[model samples]
Target chain A: MNLSKKSKVFIYILLTAAAIYFLAPFAYMFFSTFKSEAEAIAYPPKFFPSQWHPENFIKAWTSQPFGTYLWNSILVTVLTTAGQVISCSLVAYGFARYEFKGKNILFMILLSTMMIPWDVTMIPQYMEFNLFGWINTLKPLIVPAWFGSAYYIFLMRQFLMGVPKDFEEAARIDGANAFQIYWKIFMPILKPSLILVGVLNMITVWNDYLGPLIFLQDRSKYTLALGLASFKGVHSTQIVPMLCITVVMIIPPIIIFIIAQKYIVEGTSGSIK
Target chain B: MNRKKFFRTATPYFFILPWVIGFLVFTIGPLIFSLIMSFFDWPLTADPKFIGLGNYIEMFTEDDQFRKSLVISLKYAAIFVPLNMIIALFLAMLITQPVRGVKVYRTIFYIPAVISGVAVSIIWGWILNSDYGILNYLLSLLGIEGPRWLVDPAWALMAVILASAFGVGTMMLIFYTDIKNISIDIYEAASLDGASVSKQFFSITLPMITPTILFNLITSIISSFQQVTLVMLLTGGGPLNSTYFYGLYTYNNAFKHHKMGYASANAWVMFIIILLLTALVFRSSSAWVFYETEAKNSGAKKKRKGGKEA
Candidate 1:
């Protein structure tokens, strides 16, 4: 749809306005992080800090041993993302390239699981983990990703299938076996899918309030999401400066998303298409 | 050569080993055991008591809070999914034009979608605070007194829903992409045939994107049913169980109330309900979901007994 010059200008103006609208809260978050308590809540909310409270960031860091929580969150997110990449890529490769026994049936079972809401499975899984002594630890959170999520596997498989089997097929004919085909041929082709699934699941695990909330009973071991919730729960009434911490808590995932934003438009979904 | 052949044969399973183990440990093992737990009166600290169907029976017969939680979740899903999808679709349409810096708009909108659900909940908890929050301050501009959104029984669920609606960025981005990916020839043909912009959209764009719409709808419904953290952090099932989502209710029981068996039973019911709804969607999808490949398979995947071609 070709646009007239006037139309293009109007569209640009509209886009700029929309961008500001979308960016307002984030802008507010960053600037307000340095605002004093009264200044943070000042009517016609102050857009700039009258006095930069660098101490607030330090205060935010120490408000509740969030430093430890940060490490736990990072550890869990990295492990979970790494586990998902390995698990999802493996399963995705199997489903995408192979015509093995129970191939279709197994794939169907996997897809069916995608629709099963965690709400339905939460209590049951909790009970299972409780018996296994997996609670008060990150096992329930980190371990699940090691078992590939159906969605990530589906995405990975779709991407893998699209990677012209010729690469792996040639590798196979070149006296490179299947394991060699996967590692030397397919795994490299699967980088985009890997990054996509990793970032997608990382955002999910990083900001997951529910997983850690359910499993992490130890306060010292809480992930950032759960820690923030506990912070809010503890300081429900006097939550002015906690906003600073909240800003910090939400920034990492958003930054990761922004960095990967350009790649999200890579033509079409994986394995399915 | 034998080693090569052996590795060739074993490669798929080897790749899938971690996944298989994870699936059994995290998903299937827990899945089957939870079903078994639903029958027994088991607490975390005590020995299990076999009370077959007692928990399910109690849910239907005696528990009003359980009933209320179900209703609240239904209402929440009923409203939230449609609202988010509608707004998302609308915004996607608004941005689907060939404009400069439109990518920036797309990125901006997707920011909240990328933000963790937990972070969004907390930030919104501050924004919607009854006492000196942004929402009420805006409301006060019109001389209107806003109720304690998270505290008021009438508004608590709606408050959480409203908070969630802000994250429509991903859906919008998805829809925008789907809409943009509409074959250019189709639009050119439509315009050549005297179809107006709106007509082209309703005819070509809407029909082609039905698959994405259906996908979004099913996922949104499933996501809403699994409501936990936002309500947990924001409302905590609220002033009078107004926002007592079933997911949160079941969690409260299993962890807080220590009724592990009871919670398991509740979860099983929730699972059954979701399974039924998913079955219904799969059933109904034939009539509505306009998968471009559907014409190739006359019966579509759902009708096939063993496995569909999808």
Candidate 2:
């Protein structure tokens, strides 16, 4: 654990350089949002805007119906997170608690399902959703999470497996049924896993482009990701507005990441270990 | 069995019923349906007409874009996988060093991983802009003129890869955790033996985390094949279809071109390719992947066998 001063200084310098490499793009984007179209594309690109333009954010927001996109993003993200937490927990609790027929085989099937690429099922799933008239609505995106994804269920199961059986047994002895035990006893115990799944799901759902792109037809129903993508085609020449919108689009996930970073980092590290 | 016994047996099923139903309807059902659809020209506006293996034939013989996209994707994977792995491992090592304020550096480095796909592509699109980008400016400062990054066909795929390389935080964290799990005694012993840090890394740390490295390798390869959102958003298959990735090709065929049946066939081909590649990686893993527990378990088994023989 002991390090000479020279080595420590060298390490710090390398680390700081890498950090700057990672963060410089965001700082560039942040500054570019304030630049005028000409300044944004000037021959010698300016790192700092000569004039501040705080209203660019508003222009970008109002240029399209970004309010609707923001609303749709929030709606889908929250509902899917809630749905995954509830449904995956119940399924994970069942798998973790019970010794049932075909348990190992079923668990294997679940894990195998995770390996199936979204492309393979994407076409037929689109057809099926069309059959249900769920296309163009948020139903296709939101409804599936209500059933539980294999990864989240696996994570919850792993977390639950580490907890002792004494709590469930005591609850059962107190005349609590299976559902009651799951609700009262296990839900509290599984809160960390739930938060981990929820936050992860929120980031994914918020940022999901392909899902909304395929299913949703109307521009009004577009998620933030889909909406931001549309800017590329329509406003391709307007670099300032595009940069402003890009900045606007990224803030929510960055905020959530900053706030719940511990859970996200620890959750990933825990799963890997 | 009696009613109470039946209830006890079915209770777990009841709890798991939602996932079972979802799996069948959403996952298994679609998988089978897509397989069947791949055989026929299943149109969006018309009834299903079976044309048995016609779609697959067309993909192999008739589709030029499909072949190009496939090659582009393979090239992207070839470059991105090793490059991303090295960067991730290097960053992981940097952050794990005995340095002050390591957490802040880790957070800053990981910020890109949290940013949305669309945002990442857009930011990078601007950064890699031919005339006005910071990257070109930086290069010009060094007396080297930068290529038109996203605009030039020669550099478009590389641009996409460089953009994606920013988001290697997840893989880096995995390596960091595995490195953290390594017992410090090994490193101490290596130091005592006058081994350099680089020597210690290759002989001790690298061998210890081969399993994690394998896991990252397989997942990254599979995901690189599945890459779409960035290409779709940033390049849109780009000038002269240079950055036209396989996933984007399939997406365009299905949604843009409305060749759903053909796209299904394309997807199936990709699925098989992924499976085969995954199998190949796994098959090769036995040679390189080191499991400490497996060694110990086998050692114990050998001792027991020797004792019985004696």
Error of 1 at B101 (Å): 0.7
Candidate 2, CAPRI quality class derived from DockQ? medium
Candidate 1's C-alpha runs over 4 A off are A4-21, A42-45, A267-273, B1-9, B142-145, B295-310
Residue pairs with backbone atoms closer than 3 Å in model 1 (clashes): A157-A271, A158-A270, A158-A271, A159-A270, A159-A271
Write the residue-wise lDDT of candidate 2 on B206-278 in tens digits.
9899999998998899899999999988898997999999999998888888888989999999999999999
In model 1, how large is the Cα lDDT of residue B190? 82
- Name the 10 consecutive residues with the lowest summed lDDT in model 2 chain B: B98-107
- Candidate 1 shows a clash count of 5
In candidate 1, how many Å is residue A268 off? 6.3
In the range B151-205, model 1's lDDT, one tens digit per residue, is 8788888789988887888778778778877789989988889998789878888
What is the TM-score of chain A, computed separately for every candidate?
A: 0.93, 0.98
